[model samples]
Target: MNELLSTEEKRAVIELLYQLADDDFIISYRGSEWLGLAPHIEEDVAFSSISQDTMGHAAMYYQLLEELGEKDRDYLSHARKSNERKNAVLLELVNGEGHYLHEPRYDWAFTVVRHYYYSQAKKVKIESLKQSSYPPLAAAAVKISMELHYHLMHWTVWFTQLLNAGGEAKKRMLKAIAKVEAEFEDVLSLGPLSKEIVKAQLIEEESRLLLSFHANINAVFNDLSIPYKGEFTSLSGRGRFGEHTEDLSEALNTLGEVYHSDPGAVW
Candidate 1:
């Protein structure tokens, strides 16, 4: 399959794979920070499972790239420089202030909002990728959609209850929503290779995906009495374009320290 693609076509596929792989990799690390610190024990377990599943999804994408003659999955995922990642700027932000193992001031509302919003966006892309011209990607999308059903449901429960809970919960959710929206545009973007990606039918174009995304989310917002603005932007630099925040670099250091310490040791 790797040998079959034209130069531009293969580049587009590699870029798309990197974007998908990096998004899951970074966000899963963010999710892992919540371990044992969730609002309750049940949620603690659930969040960990979801993060594990997401990281597995990231591994699949990375494997696909490896088959395309890129580096091994571990090197692609654990050793790639932060600027080489193609994840959305939104997914890379720290989960609040302070260290997770120390006097962590992590915000539950922000965690809930970011994961829920990101899950929705991921679902939208996965649905389109089900029909991706690339057979392996489409197959992976089908397999991923199975797990996403439960992932979305888990987050949906939190997203709805917290937003409509009233008082501080509502206020916190709203603030989190605004902060997430500021960087959500980068999530929806397909990056500089989008034209070639779309041209090769790797997945639907970004506008089409964005339109479907809005429709899917607006229904929930309406039920909760929140007005739908549909406005999103990249306040941070675009991650898909090799631009990122120090947040990503910091995250890489923490998450990859084990692999870095002994690159030959198997996880």
Candidate 2:
């Protein structure tokens, strides 16, 4: 029989899983809303695939949570309180000032940079999880890591193409990079439980993992002849500390509406 997680291990595992699940869930929700509004038809198709992958990753995380005795995956996902959510603010932010439905002047460059940076971070985390001592999670990580190939490739292409496109696209891309850099430390952080998770061997050391992340981004920028400045900006507050934006509240309202209506009602 497989070894079950100890009590402390279970708590640690749940913390990590909730972060993973909620981050993907909220981001994918926004991505889904953007389906028909993308700049180009071909790009829209490609973008939808990314949203689907994110949702799929969320589902995988939810399944793991279910095995750990959370409410049914759907209920836990859709009915959770705003404070209960563990996703970063960046993942929950709205696409733009206006609603996604009408007259929303979404910027393609921001989308590319945001998705590219986040996807790369997700890949790094998943890679670390593949070696997690928790058997079920490690197995799931292996499966999730497989699909990242397309995701990383797709975002890389977009990141490079638009950066090279020049003009407005380049301006937009640069702005997006600035926005992403502002909040990046949050993504790299594992929150207050970082030390515990590291001790549990649930993932690799944060510093080492972050180094790998920087190396990957540096390589990409170098290939593009973009000067690789090690500096990253963070105009926004630290999201890993549970601080959030109004966008997160709005997202929780929509995502949890159906689930909150009848969290106890069997679906």
Candidate 3:
């Protein structure tokens, strides 16, 4: 696989890999913060499993980058600064405001909406990647897609149930959905390298993936008698362009605490 890739092709592949890895890594860290704070004991355990799977997916993408001659997976995941990261800004935002532990006011509605929207986008991207011209990426996409079914199901159930619950739950869910939609375009974008990524046949075009994502989500919304306005915006700076918020920096510090303490230590 290494021998087959030209310099330009390799660069594009590496860029896409970083975007994938960083997105998963940051979101999974956010998920981890919710570990024991989930609505119930059963959900706490379930959410942890999902978070672990997400981080595992990030590790897989990081390994692929390592194979392409990038920095070691640990360094890529831990040592990079927030501005050097490629995760979507939406993934990096704080759950609410206060710390996940202690008198926190984390938004369950936001979590449900964000997770549902993200999982849908991820499924669309993974489906397109399964047919990627890069055999290694296609293979990795196939592996990632296997776990995404459960991830999608879990979030979809929560999304619909919460919205259908009515009263404050429904209102909060709608508000959260609006917030998520405001910056969702960044999640659909392949960054500034979108042209090259698509030209190199690394993945499907952004428009195609976005269309599929909208269709998938709208179907769910329709089922629940919710309005399905296929509108998306990216008011936040693009993450693929290495633009991020302080949230990412704070998350990185927390997530990399142990690694920073002993970079040479073997787990």
| Global Cα lDDT for candidate 3 | 0.91
Q: Given candidate 1, what's the lDDT at residue 123?
A: 99
Off by over 4 Å in 3: none
User: Candidate 2 — which residues are off by over 4 angstroms?
Assistant: 1-3, 233-235, 264-267
lDDT of each residue in 186-257, candidate 2, tens digit only: 777777788888888999877877898999999999988888665654455555556777788787787677
Better of 1 and 2 by TM-score: 1
Model 1 Cα displacement at 18 (Å)? 0.2
Tens-digit per-residue lDDT, 1-267, candidate 3 = 788988888889999999999999999999998878899999999899999999999999999999999999999999999888999999999888689767778988998888889999999999999999899889989999999999999998899899889999999999998999898888999998888899999999999998888789888988999988878887787888998888888888988999999999996
Per-residue error for 169 in candidate 3, Å, reads 0.4
Ranking by lDDT: 1, 3, 2
Ranking by TM-score: 1, 3, 2
Query: TM-score: which candidate is best?
Result: 1
List pairs with backbone clashes in candidate 2.
Answer: 182-233, 182-234
Candidate 3 colliding pairs, count: 0
- Model 2 residue 117 lDDT? 89
